[model samples]
Target: MNTTDNTPSNIVRNFMTALDSNELDTAANFLADDFVFSGWTPKPLNKQAFLTLLENIKEGIPGLSFNIHNVLEQNTSITGTIQVQGYQTDSFIIPALGTPPIPQTASSVSLPMEEVTYRLHDDLITAMDVEHTTGGGISGLLKQLGIELPLAQ
Candidate 1:
């Protein structure tokens, strides 16, 4: 690995690529110990919780991927847009939502562009916030899968 590969841009790209390829460990390495992940669920996820979500996604959608584009870097933050695509072949567990696992629908979903923001410190990602849209991101994906989420209390 190149020592100079720790640039903000490189780290974000590599991190997302690692996730797209289902290389969880590699992706984990890019996150800080106190990392927080948000927007994928109703609440932010701690490092371990986020990892668990990724594991669930991997199990549920074998070839799931994020097609990232329009990336921008400013200070210690990186922002980008990603289109999530996958086929639901197994149960999708979202612990942060406090809902039961989403059962398989045997359907393919291609979500619209969702903006992602990553804040880094000391070359590791400290926070990731995804922009959720009503007809995009996880909500839209679930809608496409024909599984409606109960209204939040």
Candidate 2:
């Protein structure tokens, strides 16, 4: 890739690396103060809210880690699949989905590679759109919900 393409991709990759390692402070550096984190739902969040949400996530997931499998960067946007792993003490709520009021309980469920799209401002990520693999279909949704009937085996 040319310099034009490499810059943003590297920035995003670095951001992901920082994020995956639970480096919120480092990740914040790559985010604009006006950063808007779209995709996470139940209620959309702006910058400060998103930061607060991340803090809550850090509390919930504890040692959460991420592995970005495949990333594709084009003009002002990057799309990719990412695998995330974390330990859940009590069931975590899925705010993005307007599902049952009750949060699903699971010790842990291996989630699929969630698709993520990032919109950049200059080199910093300004906004994002993330779609969990669960968005695929009923089966996908069930998988994320930790209802792997037979289990993946």
Candidate 3:
């Protein structure tokens, strides 16, 4: 009930700040216990599961960073696009891909700007949705790791 500039953009900014600083606990504060995440995975992820995914990404990708382009707030929703840049420092499996683990290449990959939307309730993020705007999707990411997938016929 602390209504002092508690805009959706502010909440998301605070969350991203904490995440960028590797302060996972602080970032979690912005999320509701029943938080739901969509688009990033094949199935919706709960709050704890989302946190674990972030930790796994951090561990597998060194120097991972997000360059936020813009934040738009409307009512209880906040939307934005960001460019994710990083290099795979260790092998990791992308569950959504349903493929073998991606081995490390130490080469950098710059994902095209991807849009994300957050729904907030009571100033806590209740849900999040991501849209992969890039055309290549995970294929581009895998290529950076020196792994090529056969073109679909």
User: Largest lDDT belongs to which candidate?
Assistant: 1
Candidate 2 lDDT over residue span 54-85, tens digit each: 55545556565657767887888988776666
Best by TM-score: 1
Instruction: Please report, in order, the local distance difference test score of every candidate based on alpha carbons.
Output: 0.83, 0.62, 0.74
List candidate 3 stretches off by more than 4 Å: 1-5, 93-99, 135-143, 146-153
Worst 10 residues of 2 by lDDT: 93-102
Instruction: Determine which window of 10 residues in candidate 1 has minimal summed lDDT.
Output: 144-153
- lDDT, candidate 3, 1-153, per-residue tens: 776568789899888777766688998999999999876554678998787767766666756676665999999999988676787788776553454667766778887777889999998999988785543334555666666544321
Candidate order by decreasing TM-score: 1, 3, 2
TM-score for each predicted model, relative to the true structure: 0.88, 0.69, 0.79
Worst 10 residues of 3 by lDDT: 132-141
- Which tens-of-lDDT digit does each residue in 48-122 have in candidate 1? 888887787778887889888898989899999999999988877666545467888888989877889999999
Native-referenced Cα lDDT, model 1: 0.83
Q: For candidate 2, what is the TM-score?
A: 0.69
